[model samples]
Target: MKLLHTADWHIGRRLHGFDLTDEQGNAFEQIEAIAKKEQVDGIIIAGDLYDRRLPAESSVAMVNQMLQRLNLTDHFPVYAISGNHDSATRLATGTPWFKQTDLFLHTALSQAFKPVELADTQIFLCPYFEPFDAQQYFDDDSLQHLDQAFARVVDEMKKAFDPSKKHLLAAHFFAAGSSTTDSETNLTVGGLAAVPTDLLADFDYVALGHLHGKNALHMRQARYSGSPVKFSLSEAAQEKGVWIVDTDQTPVKLTFKTLTPIHDVKLLTDSFDHLIHSTDDPAIDHDDYFGITLTDTQPIPNVMARLREVFPKIVTLSRQDGFSTQVRYQGESGQQIRQKAPMTLLKDFYEQVAKEPLTPQQEKWAKTTLKQASEGGQPS
Candidate 1:
């Protein structure tokens, strides 16, 4: 059986406070093209079909349009699940009605263990979950997490499975092998969620998600398809793509379907005078988005306008002049301190950010003011 594996659509997500619906639309167009080019027998999206529990009306329309385009007319069966960001009930509501078109949407745990069989392939879908869901599922009321929850779910699935057949698992969770960045939002709170690679031992192939960068989980038996679009600047060089799985009723082999988006994100740093007029450098792609930083002792005049001419998609520009920065020592509040004493803790905080010590007079003034605020008396 041949399948095109994709997930983490994250529809209606915002980047730098700008709506990404149009970019997302473009991504779907690429997906359709790939699906057509590959002529795969089926498509399986593991999870995270949307960015929010309650998506905007426009996002709903966008998802509907994309799904309709993929399965309705194309005649390929699409089996998907809901992730931590989705509204399970909302996503599963019209699922029965939509099943007529070869699109299988599974959001509830009751329906999760059921395998979707197609052409000698049995795919087990598991969505993202919190500690509570597992706690409720097992009725244990303890700190059940990713490892435990997945173990429980997969164990149940194993009980009813025909081990002789090729079993593929589709999931969304943070794998321990993957690296994280400052921009990544915590998928599971309290550090209770994380699954082991070995937990899915019985499955022939595991298509995974959640981490945005592509990775080889235990030599590609388990893997992350990665996000279709670059979510943060940290993921600047990610080769965003989907996975193509071909199962031979014994083992599955994966092929990374490469996707090249129109815009490339570049980070450039130079002195404003040289950079702004550096036409001699390789011609910048007018369509690429750039994050350029100007580093100079003196501020450059008309910097943004000049660079915008060269890089049409320059969204962010920063100046790294020394004076462009600020060093402020924050006290408790505006009325909290006037001056600090050598023995004062509040005064100690004031010295940290500024990297300077408070003078004697300032300390005395602060002590007097603090004393006055402490009592009903004025600064003495």
Candidate 2:
């Protein structure tokens, strides 16, 4: 009754237009290795198998290969569901045929509420569904909100509940009190969107997903395993991995297992010059994708291009300079402005109006242009 609980695979996801298939493939390798080492009986991917509704052909191939390795080659039963990011109809394709080999995939509400029984354990798979769709599927017109729909589903499961066996709920929904990251799609319908954790308290163990932060929500035996890889800059520091649950224990023994990635997301802050001049560290993987913040007061020309020479995998660049501060307008006499250098006057004016001082390179160019104007020459 041991199971490897993982979620938010987000396969074929891109970071700053860079393809992450190789990184995701590396993650899958880690998953396979962990499954072997942990010797878990089965696997449960709560939801979000793909990054989008329709994934690329390569992504499809990648998923096919990984599933085959787990279910066919390694002979482990895999139970998966479709998250909000997945296309239910698309994911459900060939699911009937796949189940012939112990690979069970659930998508829409019509398929939910049915328990997949495994050796004295009953696994209830609850896929993501819109409240309206769920209402129609259950033929319950009173289901006006997401919570109400889920409550009805849970009530149905209770009707057929067997007290002697272990009941596990694999769900793809955000529970109240879960920490959310920017990468997740916000269901901003107020109270209609989130479901209370107490509603799912009946199950022995609840394998939940949707929110990207690992340990996002806390309940007795319910937790989100989080995305296997960092999906956004907000998730840069999160420890990405899977959760292992042993049903053999009276209360399931849950263990968090970490997975290593090929190109991990990293955030670095320093002056652009230092980052460009810093030598590559052999011990550290400099090739990791980075979100860099330049602390220089003056902007550097061709900063991205120059930094790429040293840090080729920079994905995001931001300027954290004092020049970005809003300038207060202290009235100065026009006579006093005329006494100052044109470049200095221009820089002050620009900073006041634009809320950002001119870069050193721009100041130099402005000085040259003013000198050309004073000399009666064309300014470039």
Candidate 3:
């Protein structure tokens, strides 16, 4: 059967603190259009259906609308699961009703190792499971790693797994060969939980998720479709898309279909004043969202206002050195700050700013300047 494989929609997710509801809405429309145009038999979302455990009202509405449209034709089925970032109970609340309409959602650990059979194919559903959650499933306490837990889970799945039919698995976790963005939150700590692609040899194909980047584990049988929308600055350069796989015919064909979001987000480097003043540039005039960096030593007051005046959708700005935390004040209050500082507070502030105490010579100069200020003399 032809199946559209996708994951990590992260619907209702905010990028750079800018709400991406409009962008994500457009993405959902595009996904529906692609599904219809391709005439796929089913769509499989590996995991991470919603961006949060408690989704906003608009997010819930958007999900409902998208799912309804996807199943409107009633000819194609949509299979979904929950990831580490998702709340299983919330996502699985209406699964019983969705199943009546050919939309299968398995978001509960209680339903682990269940196989949904469709047209002679057994599609195994295994959502992401933490060590503590999967503890009871393991025979020994030493089965602490994800590899060990999944190994045991797969064995259980195999018991119910129909080996005679073409087997396909859906899961969301960090695979050994996959890479993650710095912004991606870790599901588990240490190295106790990495599910290798080798764990899926028994299944004909494995659809994976969690890593935002696309492509298989450097091989073909297993693949991750990545997020359909960019979710972070690290993902600023990625091309969001979905994967389509069909095995009904001979030798399955896998296709990656690109889904472009309405609002394009880019990390743009511009001269401070140029960014502040350049309103005529095409990139600055459009509805695109931009995270700008002012490559200057000092930023003027009302910097955000000036930027937004030129680029209406400019959401974030930072001086390249802004990430640098050293603050050297030279105003009239600088001397008072130097003289009236409590050592504890001073040390805490310095630690927060990633700095050490001033050198002996510098400290002497500061004290002298403070003493002069105390005597009604200007600080040197």
Candidate 4:
């Protein structure tokens, strides 16, 4: 059976407060086109279908529309699972009737045991689950970490494997030795969640998610399809795409098809004057998301405001010199610091201390707490 593998859609995700609705919609269009061109038997979305557990109403509507186009309108079976960012209860709401139209949405641990049988293949959809979820499912109190939970989970999946058909595992988790980018949330606590790659040796093919770069994991039988759109500055240079897996072959023939982003993420480094002047160049796409690093040793007055006038999509700004540190430590003025949004200040501090951006859950919690603090009330 041939299948188009993709993951980390992160619908409704924004790049530094810039809405990515158009970019995400464009990605779905490309994916649909690719699926049609390839004429695959089915499509596998490994995980992270949405950016947050509590997505906006518009995000929900958009996803519903996109899924309808893929599964109902175009008539392709879709096999998907919930990622860490997803709310399992919300995803499971309409799942009882989803398979009637060839839509298989797996969000719970119990759903993983029963493989979705297709032509010559049995696909085990393993959604992201906490150690406690696995512990409760198995009645094993010792399953305290992700590695331990996955060990038992895989063993049970193997028990239900059909010897006559190819076994494929569609899962969402961080694999041992896999690389990560700024866009991906760390699923580990001092390496507790990293599942050993060797544990997944039994599957004919392992389709993974959570990591945004397709090259994050390098294994003969496993691959990460990655996010179709860039979510962070660190992923500006990463090629975004999907994988076409031909499972009929002895060794699955995997082919990557690139998806064009509506507005590509770009990193521009030059002196402040040069960057401002380059905005007038017709060759430069001022609409594309940009992360700028100024080479000027001295700070420019109203630099961000000036850049915003020329490049309307500048997502991040810093300096190659120590200007960024100067702004953080010895701010231009206390008023300047006070003028920054609470969330922005929190994000800067979190990134500086943790060496990574806050996860969606963390950001949401921070926002809630900040709101409560501003209102002089405690969270209920």
| Clash count, one per candidate | 2, 0, 1, 0
Per-residue accuracy of model 2 over 37-136 as CA lDDT, tens digit each:
9998889999999888989998888888888999999998998999999999899888999889889899978777778877789988888888898779
Candidate topping TM-score: 2
lDDT of 3 by residue, 50-90 (tens): 88889888888888777778876545698888987788888
Residue 260 accuracy (lDDT) in model 1: 76
| Model 3 misplacement above 4 A | 72-75, 138-140, 161-164, 188-190, 249-251, 283-286, 321-380
Q: Is candidate 1 or candidate 4 better by lDDT?
A: 4
Provide the lDDT at 246 for model 3: 82
RMSD of each: 8.9, 4.5, 7.8, 13.2
Clashing pairs in 4: none
Higher-TM-score candidate among 1 and 4? 4
lDDT of each: 0.74, 0.84, 0.76, 0.90
CA displacement after TM-score superposition, residue 363 of candidate 1 (Å): 37
* Superposition TM-score, candidate 4 onto the true structure: 0.84
Error of 4 at 110 (Å): 0.4
TM-score of each: 0.79, 0.87, 0.79, 0.84
Angstrom error of the Cα, residue 315, model 2: value is: 1.9
* Candidate 4 lDDT over residue span 274-305, tens digit each: 87888568777988899998897655668899
Arrange candidates by TM-score, highest first: which order?
A: 2, 4, 3, 1
**Which 10-residue span in candidate 1 carries the lowest summed lDDT?**
322-331
lDDT score of residue 213 within candidate 3: 75
